[model samples]
Target: MIAYRNAIQLGDWIVTTDNSGGIGEKMDDLVAVPDQITARFATRVALLEQWAAGAEPVAVLLHNFSGNASWHRYCEGIRDVFDEIGITMPPISGSSETNMSLRQSAVAVTLMGKQKLESSESTGDWYTYGTPLVGEEVLTKESEIASLTVLDEARRTGLIQRLWPVGSSGVLAEWRAATGNPDCDAASPLDVTCSAGPATVVLLQIDKEKLPNAKRHFGTLLHALR
Candidate 1:
């Protein structure tokens, strides 16, 4: 499916859902992970998805696979993100795998937001934000996943035409699906072969002339796409 901003835009609001897979087993190995750490990452992904739709988050819904883990810890994780970003979180609710025990933990996070389409700007060239991170990299390098801005800078810059969070399918895949250009060159200045899993990185479409200004917010993380 076409991802990020394009796949979500519905009327004046955008809703996006992201999944953090195999929690407590692969990505969420309790031994190496903290209770709120995964929750922060999960919350970040939800925000990015909402931002991609040019919207500010209004609510969050989670679908968790219990797998012997505490639902309270997961909720606390999401709460941590709200505290850090200084936004009162909306109602949070979802179903858990209470019927059966599982070997691994997982979560499906959904975020809802509203965007004023009437104030939208013109479109621009497509670019990828942050580096591609997938597979073992996602788990091994947890710091990279939630280390970017939550949309304040992007909105202020007024350069970002739109955004697409690179998920398990990676940057190249999401780009093709979003733009659908058969001749869309995959060769990029940054690594595009990895998967971000949740939303470690994203596809940013912006005007070429404003490329320099984008760095003011994204720093060295932004990669240009031809």
Candidate 2:
């Protein structure tokens, strides 16, 4: 397997994996949220990474450590995201740890997708497609979270030259990684160090000439990174 960004290339497929822990309805978990929500957001992060890299997900492997009772809720969360993206849910399979009682929730999602070769280079200026949000704020600022439908629309319309979902490393770190400019965080408009939680924000590169159209398309969800 060859690693490209967070995904790995295996034969003709690209695979990406992400995991979450300690944030569920379990008594000893760090955050008291539903297992479904925890699984949903965790799955969202991995899925966003796959989609941003231009992969069509075909399979999912879920790792559940929360207990047998939490398995259905986690699956529900996984399905919720698939429904949001309007894709027929892919085949899902995984394992659950039922031998020992766990104090916290732990889950992992791995997506395997087909890779499509890019014929041209992406040329454009960078922009942010959502605000940075984390923790309890993610629940409270639901509207600020980036929408998968919007991302799909932008990609279909050729408005998004490239896409990068922001994770726990926050916007600045991702911006630097995306641009190969380690010191460019000084120019960001949002909190450079704030975690985006479950990819609540995405970095988009669009041609400057198309900014108006993109702005019109994305509305308040888009913010200039500069």
Top-TM-score candidate index: 2
lDDT by residue (92-133, candidate 1, tens digit) is 888788888765567767887886434345567777766666
Native-structure RMSD, model 1: 3.7
In the range 38-101, model 2's lDDT, one tens digit per residue, is: 9888878888777766777899998999889988998999899899989887899999999998
Q: What's the true lDDT of residue 2 in model 2?
A: 15
Report, for every candidate in turn, its global Cα lDDT versus the true structure: 0.67, 0.84
Clashes of each: 3, 0
Question: What's each prediction's TM-score?
Answer: 0.79, 0.94
**Pairs clashing in candidate 2?**
none
RMSD (Å) of each candidate, 1 decimal:
3.7, 2.1
Stretches of candidate 1 off by over 4 Å are 1-13, 25-32, 67-69, 118-121, 139-146
